[model samples]
Target: MRIAYLILCHGQPAQIRRLVMALPPSSPIFIHVDARTSAAVHAEIHQLAYLRAHIHFVPRHRCFWSGYGIVKATNQLIISALASGEAFDRATLLSGADYPIKSQEHINAFFENAGDAEFIEAFPLHAPNRWSNHEGLYHGASRVDWFHVRFRSRAWRSPWRRRLPLGYEPWGGGQWWTLTRPALELIADVARKHPALPRFFRNVFLPDESYFQTLLGNSRFRGAIAGDDLRLVIWDRPEPPYPAILKARDIECLAESDKLFARKFDLYRNPEIYELIDARFLRRS
Candidate 1:
């Protein structure tokens, strides 16, 4: 079965090239480079695309961190991949900073064995102790009325004091996921049918973490979800705003994990980590 890798990238063209080259040539790659990036970066990505057939650069979206722009970009990638008519069985969303921990063959085999299940992390929004406040427990109460707003270059948490529009129970999780083509189509359809969904999530805090999860949790696709995204990410603290950049120290743990990919790597900060991975994981296959 064919797989589509949907990568969202902003910088580090060298790392992006390495990521693309490591994947199996048969898997189509669809990338969305942030529009705010420099021309040189965009040119470098275009050059990379020239080296591989079926590697596409979708329309650029001006992505803002922790904003609806991320969801918009993801939707764009899904649409672009679908429109290509490539017969991809699954679409895996990843950031440019991410790299595979498993060999491409192993990843392919694992998915093939997984059958039709979708790989995503999700949880009920109002589940007790799942959606927590600073006190560390949600106590099974809805947290919908609170709005996260960006004003004057800073984010402010204030009460929107309004309920969700579509009778959807909000859910949240890591945005990165591997979904079936049918699931991706369903998300696109949901977004298309309800213009207000994206508009409503635009003002919510980090909607990328919630938008997809909420949609799938309240739909028939929820039963098909495998409840894990299959990525090894290390968060520095409980509820960290961002995951810690992976380093050489993480190599052994990453190698041992069954997870297919790991995130937040920076070549500038930890070049040796990728080298280690290439030797122990990618090339060894």
Candidate 2:
């Protein structure tokens, strides 16, 4: 199984290097660095990537927090991975801070047995159990009915409540996912044939969580979706910066989880967690 990895990162050159090195080198890596990344930081990333020709970077997109740019960069990464002349059974999306929790062999075997299933965290917009942070959005009329977070300074609402383009049922969840080739192609095809869907998502609040998700959930592939997202992410802390910056103390929990990858490791605050994860899970037996 030739798995492809799509990574979207803005900073943390060192952490990115470690993540790239840890993955199976036989697989292709398609990365999209933020266009606004400092030249110095980009150079640092480039230097580390020079030796690994299989690790490719797409043209940078100027990303903004909770902005449409996140969706654009993610789209670029997916398109790049598909364009790469490789027939991949799985294409896993990851953040720059994410690290593999399982060994390369374990990950491969899991995907090998995964027959045509799409692993995305998805739920209907009307689901009563929708994520709480989305606040009343689960009850919104549709994706286009919601106002952009930046709609205030010169805010404007549509003349009439707009329905989701192409008749897609609103479905979304955490941005991370691992998709099979069929699911990926369907997403790309929808975007290509029906340009209206992408247009509808452009300025919507956090389109990254909805765009591809809504596309797949409404398709014939819906039944095949696992709804797991295949990632171990946490946000239980009381304070902000959710997806809590994992620490050395959290090792046992993370290691025990069946998730293939874990996210949001803060290299600055506690590098020890990285070493701990590496020694216990990343190192070869």
Top candidate by lDDT: 1
lDDT of 1: 0.83
- My TM-score estimates for the predictions, one after another, are 0.92, 0.91
lDDT of 1 by residue, 1-285 (tens): 788999999989998988898887988999999988999888987788778888988998888876778889999999899998787899899899999999888998999999889899888777743456633112222333466677422555664555666888878777899999999999999989998877778777667888898889889998887889999998764534468788898898897898999997888778999999999999842
| CA-only RMSD, every prediction | 2.7, 2.6
- lDDT per residue for candidate 2 within 1-285, as digits (tens), equals 989999988888888888888888788898898988999998888775685758888988888766678888988888888888866788999999898888888899999898888888887765654554444433333444665545322323344455687677778777999998878888888888998888888756567887777898899998987889888777787646787888898899987899989987878787888888878887843
lDDT of 1 at 245: 83
Clashes of each: 0, 0
Q: Model 2 off-target regions past 4 Å?
A: 132-144, 149-160
